[model samples]
Target: MRRAAYWLFPLIAAAVAIFIVIFMIQINPSAPHMNDGTDGEESDTSPQITEQSGSWLDRFSISEEKGYFYPVNEVSLKLTDGGTATVAAHYRLTVPLKSSYELFCVKEELKKSELPYFMRKEGETMTLFVDSNDQNRLVSLVTKLKTYQIKATVSPYTEEK
Candidate 1:
């Protein structure tokens, strides 16, 4: 009985080990081929991720831009309040934007707020144009933009003839 007990335990263990090995092999059939006839060197199966110091948008694309004043898009002044006043500024991204969805979301919010602003994508930057005779309205709009982590300064407001 003792002999049978010892043999049974080892046999169960061996069976379990064999089952685990077989399961692992079935799950991952591709084994690292080392010194195969095709090549005498081992293949690299590790993942490679190259990272650079810039905005996540830069990860989608790269530019030789040094400062924050890179023109992202083109802007045209359109006033909902029937004013020709346009505020042009080099709107810089203060935070790492998650995605272009953030821009769309902000645009939707601005539309709901009835603020006269238009954003157009030129290359990588986005252009923001605000048309309001009352500078206070523009200031309030800019202040509201801060909630979405958007920061911009007053630049030369030009009118295209």
Candidate 2:
């Protein structure tokens, strides 16, 4: 009986370890090509621009005197408090054309109590405010954006007469 108990203890421990490993793998399934041809070195893929740095809307023809020629779709803005706002319409930015060159866009979402901000269901044009220096806000927003599985695109805009 003593020898049987000794073997049983090791067997139980091994089983527990295997179970834990399996559970971890299940929780975070490895990507298809995570380890197919890598030797602990980074891949040779080109760097991607995940987010635009400067005032993107201002650069385009979306300024106050000039309205946007193209429409934005499938874009969602996430707030600091985990609240999300859907892009409704594009508006003009009141800032100077050369001063930061900011543009505004209307967004529709439930009123958030944290910011005391409300979006109009009709004729609602809200200013999209973003701080170029706020790295923390940018990181937080980028993390939340991963759930949408979207890639940023830079579309060429033509000046309207």
| Top candidate, metric lDDT | 1
For model 2 the local lDDT of residue 25 reads 95
What TM-score would every model get versus the actual structure?
A: 0.34, 0.23
Q: Which stretches of candidate 2 lie over 4 Å from their true place?
A: 32-161
lDDT score, candidate 2: 0.40
* Candidate 1 residue-wise lDDT, 40-100, digit = tens: 6654443233343354466344332432245658647654988676654422222223458
Highest TM-score against the true fold, candidate? 1
- Please provide, for model 2 over 4-48, each residue's C-alpha lDDT reduced to its tens digit, 9 standing for 90 to 100: 998999999999999999999999976444242378776655435
Every candidate's CA RMSD = 17.9, 22.6
TM-score, structure 1 vs. true: 0.34
**Deviating ranges (above 4 Å) for candidate 1:** 1-98
Which residue pairs show backbone clashes in model 2? none
